[model samples]
Structure formats: structure tokens, C-alpha cells
Target: MASITLNKLVKRYGNGKTVNQVIHSVSAQIDDGEFVVVVGPSGCGKSTLLRMVAGLEEITGGEISIGNRVVNTLEPSERDIAMVFQNYALYPHMNVFDNMAYGLKIAKVPLVEIQARVDKAAKILELGEYMQRKPRELSGGQRQRVAMGRAIVRQPQAFLFDEPLSNLDAKLRAHTRLEIQKLHRELGITSLFVTHDQVEAMTLAQRMMVMNAGVMEQFGTPEEVYSRPATTFVASFIGSPPMNLLKNAPDARPGTIVGIRPEHLDITATGWALRVDALEMLGFERLVYGRWLHGAGNELVIVRSDETQPVPGLDTIIHVTPRADRLHTFDAATGKRL
Candidate 1:
């Protein structure tokens, strides 16, 4: 296993006056055997950042180190990292065993050692029964497993995953996520996974890097990012229904905005008055969309209520109070936590 480090990494396209910068000066240290996920919305340069670490994209400026060596100029093969792409890039004509063993064979590893490695990887991935099956004979999940097994057989210093679960069905994606967690625990290889799914980042990361428009907004554990976001973008992007940012909240300080999560607002007999606009039933809980009737008079707010709570009628005025300890204050102009 190896640690990966990025020092003020930058990526730009074109040149001179037309240079379009895609990645700003981003830097982070990924400790050995740690699973770090890069997550953001589409076109946010998360994938581009991952590709740079994998030695696929040229770094416009800055340094990338894998283990103890500077790998900025190393080719993909020379970097000693295994990459698992979204599409299962398996050989259609080769059976599972041959496909997994091909890399070692090409490297001139002893035949016996290659067999042992392939066999061990297959057992770990639970693909022993399908060792002789061609790619056409396996399901999508199975094929993906074969791809992972192929990477495992090489025993590289680190692993890179580029949305490896994007093609899987929802149920299969959940199952594969568990398998990946187990794989990391057992092998303890350093890994960097890139994805747009916040749930994946929240569940799988030992630490996560949240990116926006090529700039890294925050790098911390899921709890820290969710509980105390650094900026308004992180606050609004990390949550499900998102935190409410009210510039004109009744009790908000001047020149500051108030942020409250949906679950932090409580329905009360008397408090801030809100006119109910809509209510959504989500199995175990409900989300109430309402318009605040004070301050700016039209600020929208969302409140999460459990199934036990009585549903408020639409257009009816209801009172709610934000938890004193749960309220977050941010600078109105910068959208940054104050």
C-alpha cells in the first residue's frame, strides 16, 4: 500500500489568453491504505482530478506523488496502480481465469505464481465458479467483479475507481458497495474513488473531498462535512433536501444568513409563521414545503416531520421554531459560515 499526495494541482486547457482552467490549485494528502472519495456534481472536474492521479491527464502545474516517488511524468503502467473503470473492460473471448491472469502473464511472471494469484483473487471475489465462463455468459455485476478481480491479481500499490458502479442497477450497486468495503478491509490497499453520488461518498469514504467547478471546497470525514460545512455550496450540496439558507430570516443577524436543516425545525403552537405550500410523504417521514410569512415574506423553507406528526393542510398558516442549538449562521455576501 502507498499514500497519495497532491500538491497545488492545476489543470488548464488551451494556452496564453485562451487558457481555460478546469482544476484550481487543489491539494490533499491521502494516507496509506485510506479510502478517499472525490465527490461532486457532473462537470465539476472530479473525474478529471482522478484521471490526473492515475497518470492519464497531464498536470498543468503542481506535483503528484504516489508512495515516495514523484509520478507526474510517469506513464500509467509505470505508476504501479490498478484502475477499475465504470465499464467492465473484460476480454470477451477470454474466460475469467485467463482474463485475470493476462496481466501477470504479459509481465512474464512464473506460470505457477500466476495461477495462484488468479485463483486467490477469484476466491476473494467469489468468482471461483465462473472461472471458465466467458464475458458473454456472465451478468453485469459478475462482469464487474471480474474486472475488480483482474485489478486485485496485480497487487498494485493503490487502486483507482472511476464510477465503477454507475452502470449497475440500484440494488446491485448497493450490493457491490458492500463487497468493495469488504475487499478494502481484507486487502487494505490505498484507494481513490470518484463519483457524483453523495450517498456513496458518505457511506464509503474514510474521508471525502468535495469539489465544485474544479476547486476543492472541503476535505474531511462525512460527519464533519455534513455537520459543519465550510461554505454555503458545501452546506447546500451535501444534504438530501439541502439546508435552508435564509437571508431574510426573522431572527437572522443583519448581513448574515441563517441555515437550518429540515429535521431541525419543529412545529409549534406559536413561533415563526409559515404558509404550507406542499407536503411529500416519503414512507417513514414527510417533508413540508412552506413559505415564511415574516421578514422577506416569501422565503421558502423545508421541514421534515415523522409519520406520527399530524399533516398540516395546504395554504394553512402554521408555526415552527428552529432549534436554538441547531441553527447555523453564515455571511450573507460570501455564503461562508460565520
Candidate 2:
């Protein structure tokens, strides 16, 4: 395992007056054997950042160091890093064993050592039974495992994953997430993962970096970023169903937006009355959408409940309030956390 560091890294597309910056002045330190995830919306430069660390993309400014060595000028092969792509780039004609051993063979590793490495990786990925099968014969999940196995054989200093599970179905994605967590625990290698899915970032990362439009918005553990977001964008982006923003609340200061998560609201015994406009019953929980009686501008709020208590439907009044600590305050003018 190796520690990775990015020192004021910047990537620009052109020169002089035509320069288009893709990655801003971003810097981060990833410790050895840590699982770090870079997450953001589409076209936010998360994958570009990963590629920069992998030597696939050029750095217009600053340096990237892996294991105490500056590798900005090094070739991808010389960086001692392995990347697992989203598409599971495996040779359709090659069997599992050859697929896993191909990298070692190209590096001129001894045949005996290559066999040992392939066997170990296959066993770890549960691909031992499919070693003779070609990519066409295996299932999608199995093919992804083969891709992972190929990276494992190299035993690189660090692992770079660019949405490795994006191609799988929902059920398989969940199953493979557990497998990935287990694998990380077993190998304990330094890893950098990039994905747009916030749930994946929350579950897989020891620390996560949230990016927005080529700029980093927040960098912290999953709890810190979720429970105490640094901006309104993060407050809404990190949660399921998103946070409800009281854009023009009468009680809020001028240029302030009140943020409340759905799960942090309750049907209070005595509070402002909410006229229920819609109800969505999930298996384990139900969601209530309502408008505040004293509010204007068509503002809506959501409340979650697991009990089957009767709730007024289609414009019926019910008392509801937000949890004190769960209320997030953001400056409407700048969208920054208050």
C-alpha cells in the first residue's frame, strides 16, 4: 500500500486566453491503506481527478506524489497504480486465468510467480470456479470480478476505481458493494474511487470529497458531510429525496434559506399546521408532502413516518415541525452554510 498526495493540482485544456480549467486548485492527502472516494454530479471532474493521479491525464500545474515520489512525468506503467474501469475492460477471447495473468506476463514476471498471483486473486474474488470460462460465458457480475482480479494480480501501490459498479443492475450493485468492502478490508490497500452516486460514496469511503463544477465543495467523513454540510448544494445533494429548502421563509433572516431533511421532521403535537397534498407509502416507511399554512410561494415540505397513523390527505391540516439540531441554515445570497 502507498500514500497518495495531490499538491495544488490544476488541469487546463488550452493555453493563454483560451485556457479552460477542468480541475481547480485541488489538494488532498490520502493515507496508506485508506479508502477515499471522490463524489459529485456528472461533469464535475471527479473522474478527471482520478485519471490525473493515474498518469492518464496531464497536470497543467502542481504535482502528484505516490509513496513519497513525484510522478507527474512518469508513464502510467511507471506510476505503480492499477485502475478498474467502469466498463470492465476484459478480453472476450481470453479465459479467466489468462485475463488475470496478462498484466504480469507483459511485465515479464516469471511464469510460476504469475500463476501464483493469478490463483490468489481468483480465490479472493471467488472466481476460482470460473477460471476456465471466457468473458462471454460468465455473468456480468463475474466479468466485473475478473476485471478486479486483473488489477489485484498487479498488487499496485494504489487502486483507482472509476465507477466500477455502474454497469451492474441494482441488486448486483448492492451485492458487489459488500464484496468490495470486504476486499478492501482484506487487502488493506490505498484506494481512490470516483463515482456520482452519493450512496456508494457514503458506504465505501473513509473520507469523501464532494465536488461541484470543477470546484470542491466539501471534504470530510460521510457523517460530517451529511449531517453538517458546508453548503446548501451539499445539504440537498447528499440525501435521498433531497432536503426541503424553505426559500423565502417569513421567519428566516433576509437572504437565508432554511434546510430540513425529510427524516428529521416530525408530526408535532403543537406546531404550524401543514396541509397534506400527497402521500407516498413505501414498504417500511411513508412520506407525506404538505404545504405550510402560514407560508406562501407554494413552498413544500416532506415528513417521514413508519407508523400507519391516519394522516389528512389532499389539503388536510396536521401539525408538523422540524428537529432543532437537524435544521440547516444557509445564506441564500451565496448558498454557503451559516
Candidate 3:
């Protein structure tokens, strides 16, 4: 139950002549019991920052604290933290119960206390029925849960997860996400998760950090990041199929890019007309793609609708309209929201 703080964190490799800055001057405060996900594209340094906090990576500069203690110089074992890696890392020969109790054994916790903690964790993770099962006997999702249970039995001040669900199938990943959320609520331990999946970040985070090329793009609730993205990269990266970033003229007022989400589009009877290019009928919803009018060029604009309207033939005319708020403007030079 500790709040984590980062102050001007910096990670650089090589000397000043060729410094490869993996993390810039990063600073953030994660409240106690907060479930914060750090999300970014590959090579953006989200995992680097998480590793620094875990003491797995050295911080070139700045301060990191857990509760009121500065832990930058502490070894991973001394940080009062538990980490659940992407790989389950379970011992092949160890049974679930043994795996969960191993940490306590290493710390010389009394046998009875270890049993009580392991048993409690097993119940929480629904592993009571599989306590005797070895890693080979369990499914991928089960192994992931076992990794989580191992961390839980420690009752550490915080938990760090690095793409914990990357290996699971879609359904199992979704189920496990819910389980993790529930576990967070039950344990109330401070947690930091790192992932590239926007869906996972959106669903699992109470607050989140969006990182880009080692710099934090945004830090706020999922709603704030989604509804009011601070930059064009964030606007495009946070949503499915991403926000449409249409290029406008250099003299295009204050906004060089016009953004619109597919769901916010309207199938208007009269508006900027276009020729139907393609359609995707997805049971409950449909995506319509068409060429924009006003010499808007050969590129396509996408719109989503719930009603399976007439599937227009290729090149057939279709008009589009969008809600005013759904339309976004971004500065051309910096690609920042306007």
C-alpha cells in the first residue's frame, strides 16, 4: 500500500557525444492502490520506465520513491515489490501450491504462515482445485494466473506487470483482465502495468500513461486520454482503426489535420458526397468507406453505423456528416491538438 513517485527520471546510454536517451525527464505520481497502465508503440520505452521502477534497469538521472523511501539504489529484492513478467516463469516440476509457497520459503516465513498465505491466494485465484497440478498440466491462462497468485501470496507494497496477457487468446485475455481488475480491488496494492494494446490499457487502467519515444504523451484517466487526446499521435493510437487524420491545406486555419472517429460519423441524406469504396458488415455495426467530395482526393474516409443500410455498389454516391464535437483539429507543425 504505497504511492510511487518519479521525479525527472532519465535513462541514457553512451557518452554525451552519442547519448541514446531511452527516457527523458519523466515525472509522475501514482497514488496508493491506483492501477496505472503505461502504453505505447514498440520501442517507445514504456517497459524501460517500468524496469527502472523495478530496479531491473538503471536510472541515469532523477529520483524514484516507493512510499517515502528513495529506492533508486535498492536491489529489486529490496524494493518491497513483486513483478509478474510476461512469461509465466513457473518451475516445470513445482506444483501450484509449491510454486506459490516458494517465495515465503526463501524469506524463511514460518511454515504455517506460508500455508495460510498460499491457501488464501489459491482461493483468490481459483487455484484451489489445481493446487497439485504442475505447470505442464495447466493451460496458458492457468499458468498466468499461477504467476499472479505467486505475487499475491507475498502481499508486497506494489505489483508490476509487463504485458502479462500478451500470450493468451482474445477470450482468455479478456477474462484475465477482469480477474486482474477484481484482484486489484480486493488487494488494493499499488500497480503499474505496461502494454501496447490500447484495448487492454483502456479497460484495465484507472489512470494511464501514454508514452511515445520515451516521452510521456499523456497521463490521465482513460476517458481523458480517449475523448481529449493532447496530440495527433495519441488521437490516432488510442482508438480501434484509430482516428482519421485528414490532411488539410497549409492555410487551413489553425488546424492542419482534421480528425474524426468512425463511430462519430453520420450517414446524412445531404452533405459532402462521396463514392462508396468498401463496406464491412459486423453484425451489430457496419463500417462504410468512401471517397470524399470537394476534390478531397483519392484517399478514403470511414464511417460506422449500426443499421445495415443498403450496401451501395462501388462508385455509388454516399454522403457523410459528423457530430461537431467529434471533429478535431490538430496543428500541422507539431501534430498537437488545437
lDDT of each: 0.93, 0.90, 0.89
lDDT of 2 at 112: 95
Which residue pairs overlap in candidate 1's backbone?
none
Q: Candidate 1 lDDT (Cα, whole model)?
A: 0.93
Candidate 1 regions with alpha-carbon error over 4 angstroms: none
Ranking by lDDT: 1, 2, 3
As a whole number from 0 to 100, the lDDT of residue 106 in candidate 3 is 90
Clashing pairs in 3: none
Candidate 1's displacement at residue 116, Å, is 0.7
- Tens digits of lDDT, candidate 1, 1-338: 89999999999999989999999999999999999999999989999999999998999999999999999999987898998988978999999999999888988999999999999999999999999999999999999999999899999999999999999999999999999999999999999999999999999999999999999999999999998888888889998899998887788889998999999999999987899999999989899999978656778999999988899999999899999888889998887788
> Evaluated with TM-score, which candidate comes out highest?
1
Worst 10 residues of 2 by lDDT: 305-314
- What is the C-alpha RMSD, rounded to one decimal, of candidate 2? 1.6
**Residue-wise lDDT of candidate 2 within 46-95, one digit each (tens)?**
99999999999998999899999999999998999999989988988999
Worst 10 residues of 1 by lDDT: 291-300
Backbone clash total for model 2 is 0
